[model samples]
Target: MSRKRSRLSSEEEMSSKLSDGGCGEGQNGSETSITSATSQAPIDALQSLRQAAPYSTEPEAIAERERCHYGRIPRAAALAGTAHRKVRVYSDGIYDMFHQGHARQLQQAKTVFPNVYLIVGVCSDSLTHSRKGRTVMTEDERYEAVRHCRYVDEVVRDAPWEYDEEFLEKHKIDFVAHDDIPYTTEDCEDTYALIKAKDMFVATQRTEGVSTSDIVARIVRDYDIYVRRNLARGYSAKELNVGFLNEKKFRLQNKMDDLKEKGKKVMTNIGEKRVDILTKWEEKSRELIDAFLLLFGPDGRLSNIWNESKGRLMQALSQPPSPRGSPPPGENGDSHSPVHSRSSVSPPPPKSRRYETLYEAQAGNWMHRALNVLATRKRPHSGS
Candidate 1:
């Protein structure tokens, strides 16, 4: 009896084996038993098996599934919902010198839309070369850097040409956003037309002073002290005149008027020396007018004769004063007067030449003398 019982237990174990050839009962009974065994597995193990399988409702998967169901909606239909959904798209170039202005522009763009999707399209180094001649950063570096920006949501390689409308439509874009830069309208219009045709919106935000070119210029200017020093050393009189005086002509004229008013107000308080200096300046100004008239006067012979005499006088005046300190003898009977004391001063003697010619020569001589006197005197007030 004990042997028979042990044999029965062995048979039962064999029947429950994973790969038994057949059931002792029949094929139909074996199928039913196998099904029953699988059903009897632990609930935890079954749960784990289900979990190991891929998720059917993931975001990407759901999008794909929805895409399939919608069968790629028409570009028009995609844009139909744009009016209600405020979506903004921003794009730009190198952004190498990223500053507060750029940040502000992005911030303003974000404020304008409910859903801001910054689609940064960095030009490839090769494409940038074709358009801009060169770029400061490599394509990969630009891509990585733009990716790290807080405002940027996605990055793409911008082609040599403009953004493709079809691609933008496929993405269901709404408003196209950019900084308000010169020529941006012309550039964006070609791309904007497509967006507008699809009934999508467009916007532009004003950026302050930040620009890649401006940044580069600032860098060059800041570090170019050597160049500036060399320029100062080699500076020319004409260049200085143009740069300092001529450039500020309008402002200087206005300042001169203001100074004249101030001088009038303070005239009584000024000293005798200051009065003398101001009188000399006024006399020099009159001499300038006389010189201009001499050059462009109606009498050609008179003007030519005056210029020759003035040149000779200037040469004589430029020479060192004689040690004896005596005036040259006059043609008239009256002897040359003393040069020192203001009370003993005497004007040039009358000439025997034609009265009109002598008068003209004397006037020209007096004007030249007055100019020299003014030049020698210390200026009371600086003129503009």
Candidate 2:
């Protein structure tokens, strides 16, 4: 409950500052602004909102430094010794993803009168989820978002759907700030009727263009990215509730031939491109699967190529070049070193420095290492 207070002289101006109807005034003509309390952003008449107030900070010195960077107005007011009654303006909502609209609404509410304290109540996730399908933000998240709004002085978690006389009296609520429209839910007949009858309803305009649904729709439109992201996170297609390609096979088997033969009748270039992409993807995956199977076979035969190639190269390299021929070992003490003859298998001509851009076939270091390991482990005595 907030203390009772008097309206400011800027009543007329305050009305225009909110929506066209002016921010809501209580049953007694006390005023304040509203907070949209849905999981998704609200969709309503659009208006050009004023710039949002900067985030609150502790320590005036620190605040000053940050404000200087953003060109924000210093937070200050001269209500210390004023004789005016302290006003308590009440407004609340789900406030799922708080933004400029929420800020604008709250500002209108608290600033509608002098010496104001704004109390905002955020609905519980259970309540919100029951009424709405799904909320992107949790109940706690919504509470924090609304609690920090520049307009809010206090926040109530799991706020009640309708106001009660006791709640009003305890807080000394002078005016309940909200739009004039009826706020009916399963829990209450008219959420604001009691306040309105007491003359506390204030009408604020709904900001347009941005809402939770709009944001959700944008993500859905880029569905492929969503699927890819889930995969990257180690979530399988089944885990993501995606249908298996086998299930969608009919879509292709039955229609691909028709599309290729008479595709122009219904399919455009865009459709053809998609078909080609799918075909290419399938072919590529098949190739990779076959390659891996052979490479990791029981005998690991793929490594044999590596060993054979390295053995030839090493044998060629081991032979020393000789300027003079040595005679074969002679009988008795007169012996001579045997002349080593050049083998038919000679090292291929020094490799030409082929352009890497041309991508000539070459066995990379890994392949060579694999072959060498296989050849070194072979047991001639245990040959089958």
- Highest lDDT: which candidate? 2
Model 1 RMSD in angstroms = 31.2
C-alpha lDDT score of every prediction, in listed order: 0.53, 0.57
Cα lDDT of model 2 by residue, 270-293, tens digit: 675888888888989988888787
lDDT of 1 by residue, 53-97 (tens): 112233542352344322323335434534323243545565554
Clashing pairs in 1: none
TM-score of each: 0.35, 0.40
Q: Candidate 2: where are CA atoms >4 Å away?
A: 1-83, 186-189, 229-384
- Residue 206's lDDT in candidate 1: 57
